[model samples]
Target: MTSTVSSDLRERAEAVLATLAGPGARLREDQWTAIHALVAERRRALVVQRTGWGKSAVYFVATALLRADGAGPTVIVSPLLALMRNQIDAAARAGIHAATVNSANTGDWERTYAAVASGEVDVLLVSPERLNNPDFRDRVLPQLTATAGMLVVDEAHCVSDWGHDFRPDYRRLRTLISELPAGIPVLATTATANDRVVVDVTEQLGLASGEPLVLRGSLDRESLRLSVVRLATPAQRLGWLADHLDALPGAGIIYTLTIAAAEEVADFLRERGHPVASYTGKTDPQERLAAEADLLDNRVKALVATSALGMGFDKPDLGFVVHLGAPASPVAYYQQIGRAGRAVERAEVVLLPGREDRDIWAYFASLAFPPEPLVRQTLAVLGDDAMSTAAVETRVDLSRTRLEMLLKVLDSDGAVRRVKGGWVATGEEWVYDRERHQRIAEARRAEQQAMLDYIDTTGCRMQFLRRQLDDPASERCGRCDTCTTPAWSTDVDQDAAAAAQERINRPGVEVAPRKQWPSGMAELGVGASGRIPATELAEPGRVIGRLSDIGWGTRLRELVDGDDAPVPGDVLDACVRVLAGWGWEQRPVGVVGIGSRTRPHQLDHLARRIAEIGRLPLLGTLTPAGPRPEAHANSPQRLAALWSAFEPPAFPVPNAPVLLVDDVIDSGWTATVAARLLRRAGASAVLPFALAQRG
Candidate 1:
C-alpha cells in the first residue's frame, strides 16, 4: 500500500462510487478480493490472467470500491476497438455511461473535454496515442491534476518492443501518466503476460516503487492433444491431410503461412468435397461476421486460414488445429495453436513442417526492412514540420502502403513523430548514411535470424521463448517433437524408407484404394510393394494400382530388402485413377472393428458403391511404407455422413450465392475455388467459411 490519500479523500471516493452503482450490484469473490486489496492498500498491481478470468470485472469492482471509499472516476486506456465496444456496451447495459475515445463513434471533442475536466465521466477508454496528443493533454490534464482516481492500461504488453503486437505510441504512455497528479493509482491488465513483461510494465510506467501484484492463471488445456508430423513432400502432406480429415470429423482449423498457400490448400481440400471456410485479411467485415456465425452454427466443418482469424476469438470447442507449415516464431506458433482446445476436451495440434516454412519469415523480414535510404528519404519528405501519417505517405516516393509501414518502424524506433498533418522528424536528425543504412539492414536481418533460430532450435522451444523475453533460464519442455520424436534424417534416407516398408507390410495387410473412397476424402497411404500394371498404377486408388504406381521402376528385390528407392512422385498427384482389379476379401471400410473382425462388412461395400458413383478415391493407401492418421479417418465413417456433409441443404437454393470454406483464406482465390467446387457439386448457393481472416 502506497496511498497518500487522506481520510477526506477516501470518503469522497466512497461517496462517488455509491452515487453511481446501486447496493444490489454485488461483485464476485475474486473481483471483491482484488478490489478490496487495491482500495484498502492503494496498491498498484498487474493482473495477469487468461481470457474469461474476470480481469475487467476485478478492475471495475475496484473502481466501485474506490468510489465507495472516495476516488474519482477511473480512466481506462485500451487498444482494441472490439474490446472497447464490448466494454462500452456492457457499461451501458449496466447504466454506467462509459464513453470511449477510439477511432469509431467519435464524440463532441468539447463535450468530452469538459466531461473529463468536470469529473463528470466515470470511466474513460481511449487509445494510448490519444494520450500523447498535445490537445488531449491540455484539455484532460486539468481535471486529472487533483490526485483523481486511477488510470488503467489494458493490453500492457503492447508497450514492450519484444511483444508480439508492439505499439510505438505505447512507449510514451508512462510519460503521459507521469503528467497526472502524484498519488493517483495506475492499473494494467493483459490476458497473456510472462514475468519479464510484468517487470517491464511496472518499470516503464514509473511504478517500480508501487506495490506490484503479479498473477498468472492456468495454461493447461486438457482437451487438446498435441502432435506433429514430418512430411517429405507437398503431395505426401496432402495425402496425410486427407486422412486426418477422415479421422477427426468436426469443425476445426488449419493454419497456413501465406495468402496464396491458404487459398491453395483450402481450394485443394474443397475440391475433395469438404465443407470448409477460408478467411484472411481480404475478407470483408460482414463476410467475417457471417463466417463466424456459420462456424458457431456448425454450417462449416473446417476453416482454412492464416493467423489473422484467432485473436480474441472465444470459440471454446474447436475439434483440433492443424499447422500447414511451421510458424516463424514460437510466440506466433503458441498463440495460433492456443485458439484450439479451449473447451478443455480431447483436441490435437498437428504440425506438417516443410523446408519451405523456414524461408517464409525471412522473405517477410526483407519486405519489412525495405531500404534504409528509402525510409530516410520518406521521412525527409515529411520534413521537420508536424504532419499526419497519411500526409507523409502522400509525399513519399514509395508506395502509400510501404511508406506507412516504414513510418511505423521509424516511429517505433523514435526517429519521427506522428502528428496531425504527417510524421515529423523528432530529436536528432536522421542520416541515410552508408553506416546507418547498414545498421538498419543488420538489425532487420538479426530480427529475422532470431525468428528462424526459434523455428529450428534443437532444445526446448519453451526455454528459447523464455530467453526471447529475457526471462530467467527455464528447463526444457519435454513434450515437444524435438524431445518426443526420434530424428529421422537431415534428409530422407534408407532407414526411414525401410521403416515405411515395414509399416506397409505389417501383418493383416489391408489396401483401401482411392477408388473405394469419396472424392476429397482424406486417407493414410501404406508403403507396400508395387503390384498393378504400370499404366494405371500412378492413380490414387485401385489398391494394387496405387501400390504399383508408387513402386513402379523399383525392382522387386529392392522392395523386398526394404532398400530406399525414389518414390514414384507422379502417383501422389491430386488426381490419378486406379486401374487394377481385385478387391481384397477384407471387411467393409468404416465398420467398428470390435475385437477379431477380419472381413469387409456390408457398410464398407455401400461406401465403395458410393465412391464408384461419385468417381471418388478409396479411403486408405495401398503402398505400405508408412501410414499417416488420415488413413483411418478418411477410409471409414457413418456412410450417410459422407454424402450429406458435402451435399448442400435441400430447398430453394440462394440466388447466385457462392460458398467457400478453407483451412485458411488470406485472399479470395481459395474461397473462389471452393465456391466453384460447390457449384460443380450441385450447390445452388455458395458462402465462405474461413478459420481466420487476416488484416
Candidate 2:
C-alpha cells in the first residue's frame, strides 16, 4: 500500500528535524522512522506498543513537521500537570516554542493562551478538564482550528473505557478531535493498548479502518525476570518484603491500592531500615515530585504508590516493581509490572496478591452507580445551558463533589460545557434526565456484570483478560494463577468447583469499611467524663472530625457532634506525627467535651462575618442554624501574616486555604472544606486543626 506524501509535507517534516541537529539532539533511528511514517500516513492510526517505544517522540516530531510547513499551531492534550511542564521543557530544549496551561501555572496562563491563539506557539499542551471551559471552546477552539497544524492526543488510552486510566474528559475528546477539519491528520498514541481500545478509538473518533498499525513489538524483555508468590498471610508478605529490601535492593516501586496501604508499606519498609518514598493521589504535587526525584536520583530506593503514580513516569532504570496488592485488571497489572525491566538486562515483577485485591475491585465497581437521589440531582443540574460546575452546585441541592463527577460524565458525552458561572447544554442534544438515569444504571449493571465475569472466568486469568479485550492473540500466559496453578497444585482437585475453591481462597472475603478508628483513645488519659467542655467546644472556628475510638467522640456527646463527622481522628495526628518525628514538639487538643446554645447576637455576628468574608455561613433551618464561631475561625495573626507573605490574587484567592470552622467534629466536612479551600487558594498545605472530634 504505497502512497505518495506531498512534497510540501515531506520537506516540512525534514526541516523540523534539521532544527534539532545539534550533537545532543540526535533523534534515535527508530524515532526518525516513526516520524517518517506518521508524516506520510493520511489517516489516523493507533500506535500500540510497549513502553519505551518512542511514542512521545513520534508525536513531538509530528508537531515539528506541521510547524515547519506553517500548518499554524499544534495542541497536545496531555493528562498530567507534571507532564505538561516536562513535555514543554523537552520541546524547548529542542528549540520548539511550547507552553502549558494548568491551574498550577495560572499566573501566565492568559498570556500563554493568547500566544497560542495568535499562532505564536508551536505547541500548546492542555489537560482534558481545561478543554471543558466555554472560553476554551469559544475563544480557543475556533482559533486553534484555524491555526492548528495538527492535533496530538498523548496517553490516548485515557479515552478507552477498557484502558487502565479511564477519564471522562478523555472520552469527550473524541468529539473535539472529530470536530477538527477532515484532512488534518490526527495522531492517537499510547504506551499500552489491546484490541478493544483500538476499535473504540476508531469507531468513536473516525480513525483508520481494517486494523490500525499494530507495531507489536516483543514483550519478552530478557532483562526482566518475572516472579509471583502466593502470600495468604500478612506475616508472610511482611517477611518477604523485608527479605527483598535486605537483598537485591535497588530503585523500585511497591504498588498498593489505597493511600493508607501506601503509607503502611512505606513505613514498614522504612522501619526495616530501607530507603523508601510514597506516592498517591493524596500526596501533594510538590511532594510527589520530590519523591520521584529521590528515586530518579538514586537517593531513595523505592516508591510505594497507587496506580496514579505511574502515568507519564519515564524512569527507565527502575530495578523492580512489587505489587503489594494485586491489580484489578490485566492491563493495570501488566503496566505496573512493566515499569520494571525497561533496560536490556535483568529486572523483576513480584506479585504478592493477598485477599484484599478482589474486594477492592468490587468496592470500586459498586461506586460505578451512585445513589438514586444523586443521579436525579445530577441530571436536573445539567439542564439546558452549559454552566460552570460551581454554578450548577448553587442551583442543585447536591454536594459539589457529587455534582463535579456527574457533570464530568455528561461533559464526556459532549452534553454540557462548564462555562464561567454554570453548565451550558452543549452537545447536539442533552441526555434526558430519566433516560440519562437509565443509561447510567445500565452502565453500572454492565460494570457489575463484567466484574462477576472476571470473578468466575474458567480459563487462565490472563487469557480471560485477553478475550475480554477481544484480542485474537489470547494465549495462556505462563504466569498468573490459573495458568500455573495445575502444575503447582497437583494435590488439588481437578473439577471446576475446586478451581472456584482455589479462587475463593485468595482472601478479601471479609469486607470492611475503608476507615480504621483510633487505636488508643483510652490511653490518651482522657476519661469518660473528662473530655473538653461543650462550651469550649462551641467556641466556634474549630475544624472537627470523628474520633471513634478516641475520647474526642465521647466529648462530642456534649458538643453539637452529629451523624456525619469526617473520621475517627483529626488530621492533627498525621501532621503531628510528621512534625514530631522531625524533632518538633507540640501539644494537640485531644477531644471536645461540651456544647452551648447560640445567643441571638452570635447569630447576627455570624451572618455579618459570612458577609464580610465572602463565604457561605453554616446554614440550618430550625436546627440551631447559625454560623458557628468556627465559621470565621482562623488565627487572625497567622491569616494576616500568610496573606501578606503570599499576596494571593483577587479572584477567589488562588490556592488560599480557607477556614472550615465548626462547633463539633461530627463529620469531617469543616476540615475537608477548609483544606480544599486552601488547595484552591494556591496554598500548598491545608492543615486542619480542631478542638474536638465526633465521628
State which candidate has the highest TM-score: 2
Clashes of each: 81, 42
| Each prediction's whole-model lDDT (CA) | 0.52, 0.55
Q: Write the per-residue lDDT of candidate 2 for residues 1-695, one digit (tens) a residue.
A: 24345545544554554554434344555555556555565346566656765566667778776566667777889898766766776687557898888777779878997787677888888898888776777877777776667777887878765566767777667777667775566777776676667766666555654334545443434445455566545445655665555444368888887665676567666766788988988898899889888988889878888887776776778888887766666666666666776753656566666655555565565444345565556666565654555444434434444456667777676666566666766534543456644664565455445534554555555455445444444465665445554312212123423332332222111111112112222332312123322221211233322322111222334333343333223333432332233221222211111122443333233323432333333222112223343321122211222222222223333232223323334344333323333345454333333334432
Candidate 1's TM-score: 0.55
Off by over 4 Å in 1: 1-37, 50-54, 67-74, 85-101, 104-123, 128-148, 191-199, 209-211, 216-220, 246-252, 296-299, 367-402, 405-416, 425-695
lDDT digits (tens) for residues 1-695 of candidate 1: 33454344444434433443444444444444455556766666776655545566666656766655568877788876546755665555444557777654455666776676676776788887676565665556555545458788887877754445556567776766667665666777765556655777777776676566665555434444455566676555555665456466357888887765665566666766677778776666666667766776778877778766754554667777888777765555656666676555566667777666645655555444456666766666666777665334333434444565567656645687666555678765555455644654575456456656765578765456556544444465555556567322223344434433432222111122122222212221222122322221211112211111111212222322242332232321211222222232321222110010121232233334434543544332111112221111111222112222222322332333322212222223323323333444344443332212321
Candidate 2 overall Cα lDDT vs. reference?
A: 0.55
TM-score versus the correct structure, for each prediction: 0.55, 0.64
Question: How far is each candidate from the true structure, as Cα RMSD in Å?
Answer: 18.2, 13.9
Worst 10 residues of 1 by lDDT: 590-599
Cα-lDDT of candidate 1: 0.52
